[model samples]
Target: MPIKTPDAANPCVFISAEDVGKVGTETPQELAGDLGFLSNMEMIRQAGSFRMGVTPDIAAAKQMQSVPKVAIVAAPTDAKIQSGKVLLGTDVDLVVRMISMQQPHRAVPITGALCLAIACRIDGTIPARLARATLNTLTLSQPSGTIAVDANVRYINNTPVALSGTVLRTARLLFSGLVHH
Candidate 1:
């Protein structure tokens, strides 16, 4: 069953390793390697469409509808960090990369991070399987440094429920401007 917050405006979609094959042919590790040299967001979008077995139009529509935030949670792989200064440690449980229609194709937003944290706590998802016992937080290793999310999951009748998730983000006010449409 796909778990979603009942009243969420844009609910997160969690795809496990097994079900990921239904959505995309390439795994997260494979996509990471293929995306190594590509900088164009359009090309990345096309690749994602091909892997997900959807036309560009259909993918766009789906991104607008059912699953806006799609994440692939897989077992950790040896990936170069953002600076190329260091490789990720093997202790990292799972690596996640999200694709969304509302933001840049390659960027990981706070919503994606929170979704991954919630997915990590769910009982049967790949992330939950790979997650280590780390108290109440799940550490996600992205291209940048690790992001830690504080998750509180409560279970009712043996089903897990996500009560709340929190992630600390650092942002700078780049340019405050008004857009005149």
Candidate 2:
């Protein structure tokens, strides 16, 4: 589903689980590097995950207007990357984790929403713990906390359609600078 008002921040982008590129592992340093300063995506460890020694790059959260489209998921084999943290990312239009550098590990709801949407799809593309909890509600293990995203896909002759696409995102926010004073 697409965002209304172009001012909201839930469901940043939607893509089928099977559409992501090959998966990859992220080094602790890599996940902590300066990212999302505007374009580069990065992660912030959950408060619980961070207590186990996950470090977040607070410096990278610059004045950039774009939120991340990246994700750090927990595949079955990805129980722990460092300390007690599970940081597995995909070549998704993923949102690098929107973890805050400090506090309760605040994260944007859209990331959790996006991730849960991927796992809850009817397709079996993502085989993981999160993928198994699709009874109705999905519990997303975000760095800050857990979030649940409910989705409904309208099938026209068995084909899934993206209602809003990315036009609103680019046209209203990303491209605002080009057209706005």
Candidate 3:
């Protein structure tokens, strides 16, 4: 039986088998490139936002029985410099949890980087019209894409926007001979 809501009626978003198939094939490939490189990058792209690899073992946290579960975590680092006049850019982190399990922890990096980059582009602003134009020229958007959520806070007299978010990509189901539909 189909489920129904009290006020509205239909679901917020609907994903057909075809839509799911397209998402499966195109999303990760376009976003992360090869899995090996992506994994390493996600692990290394330091700055808080990238969280694709390791997360808390929630099941373990929830359990009164067994050991419960495990998790994967990533730690990244980088170096940047502001020469001439000092410029402080807002620091943001976007995170995505692609998969989860119990026992141990792990994560993929390239996907995390791409996901964070897209999110930063979406919410960050430019100093001027010219600067914004240049940034648009240099930015790239992820295709199909991973699911990411943002956590933002303003700091230092609103001079910098500190943000953190998570992204997710789910495995697709195979049906019959076709990819999905």
Candidate 4:
């Protein structure tokens, strides 16, 4: 199922662990600071490979040129969420991190949050494996804080085929003036 943001701009498709190469890889004893970033890059590369009908080796050098060159990953249990606004409680089922094509790859965008929440409900996805069974709400532990999303999953033939998710995020306009470049 594809997850689209409220603006209908960013569309995300969930990929399986096998596709992302997380199936046979050993779970790291400790998640290095850049582990998620590296993983996300790899996922992006893999997606690019699939899109271009090539191997990851060739895609690694050219993945950055691909459209929608970004990826998000669900953080494992060991990784900690560094945020002062919200305390990390036991209810945190998933932690989402965004990796983009630009610098400062790590981020916690609202769209990514919604996508992660929806992905959690889908079976066989990385987020689904880590997510706890919930009726509708999912608390995604991001770097900034936790985002709560209301999601509904529709099943077909015992498989998730569609998802509807909504999240309320507080956005403040820091600066709104036109700038001369």
Candidate 5:
């Protein structure tokens, strides 16, 4: 499922319940840090099983005048990490949250960033075409970072990388013999 493009000031990403339950993720701090300037240590928040936080930016302001940023990134854990499989059950509903740091005057779509992350994770490559599609469809500017093909393990309510694939394989195998002609 595609993520919705949030308003300029308060951008967020939302996926279907099914997708959220299937992907396994790393600790919120690790994902945040890996995202470079988007994560901050002090803004981290733990609510029930979900983790919420903000990113701090001193350099971004000096660098770009037209980017929507949140001094924080938040992730809610929808599944537990076990044998590289994130169970697709109702117990967990993972969602990634980010706030807009850009001045209200400048309209920047922050949810595009989250959408890009999800697209890259599912395809293992962020094609320029796809990025372009996202920009066009979401009505947002193209972000800076290039989507390099790398080994990514997004925990919690992030992307469904290799671990999610592994889990899917297992499920298919389990049903393989049962659904016979």
Candidate 6:
């Protein structure tokens, strides 16, 4: 099941699966592209409006709808700019445990992860990758692609505090020109 983060800034949802193939089905690949459905406000609206407890048919999380959990499922580097182009999907499938979706990216969003990072501290929250006592990074797989979120969560007085959440991304030169200031 996917849990919608309570965050209002950069809303996101987290879920778990058995493998990557099952992860991509959230959109069912009918309308979205090979990159999968775009994770943006559209997804947020769709999920927010979902009936939640009641819905005999139709999945609230479209791409994820009715897809049986089979399997589950990122990285980047620093540079002012780089040559590599961002691609959709990965060559290797994952035996992943948890996944996330954030706006402007079908993949994982660092901002989204921040919300989850804090949520993880809550008492009732199900720990992502429960097998591990500590989770330093979170791998999120979606229809379009996947990515890893770098999380630095600190604890104070048994309360979880979010220090930082980041993602490394390759940069492409979008424009290079001189401007008269």
Question: Which pairs of residues collide in model 4?
Answer: none
Q: Residue 124 in candidate 6 has what lDDT?
A: 44
**Model 2, span 1-181: residue lDDT tens:** 2122221133232222223331323333444553442122222222222222222323332322133233444432232333556634221222223333321123435543543464345354332333544435444443433344544544578854323211111124444334556
TM-score of each: 0.59, 0.37, 0.21, 0.57, 0.21, 0.39
Off by over 4 Å in 5: 1-93, 102-181
Candidate number of the best TM-score: 1
TM accuracy, model 4: 0.57
Q: Candidate 6 has what TM-score? A: 0.39
What tens-digit string does per-residue lDDT give for candidate 3 at 46-150? 211112212233332233111111111111111121122211221212112232121111232334333333324433421111112223222212222223333
CA lDDT of 108 in candidate 6? Answer: 34
For model 5 the local lDDT of residue 70 reads 33
Provide the overall lDDT of each model, using Cα atoms, as 2-decimal numbers: 0.55, 0.34, 0.25, 0.51, 0.28, 0.37
Order of all candidates by TM-score, from best down to worst? 1, 4, 6, 2, 5, 3
Better of 2 and 4 by TM-score: 4
User: What RMSD value applies to candidate 5?
Assistant: 17.6
Identify the candidate with maximal lDDT.
1
Lowest summed lDDT across 10 adjacent residues in model 2 is found at: 162-171
**Candidate 1 — what's its lDDT?**
0.55
RMSD in order of candidates: 9.2, 16.6, 17.6, 8.4, 17.6, 9.8
Q: List, residue by residue over 1-181, the lDDT tens digit for candidate 5.
A: 2223323222222332233231223333333445432322112211100211112343323343223333221123333332444433232222222223322112113343444344334443322222222212221111111111222335456634333111111123444355668
lDDT of 1 by residue, 70-153 (tens): 555556656565555443546465666565642323435777777677767778766687666566556666655567676777
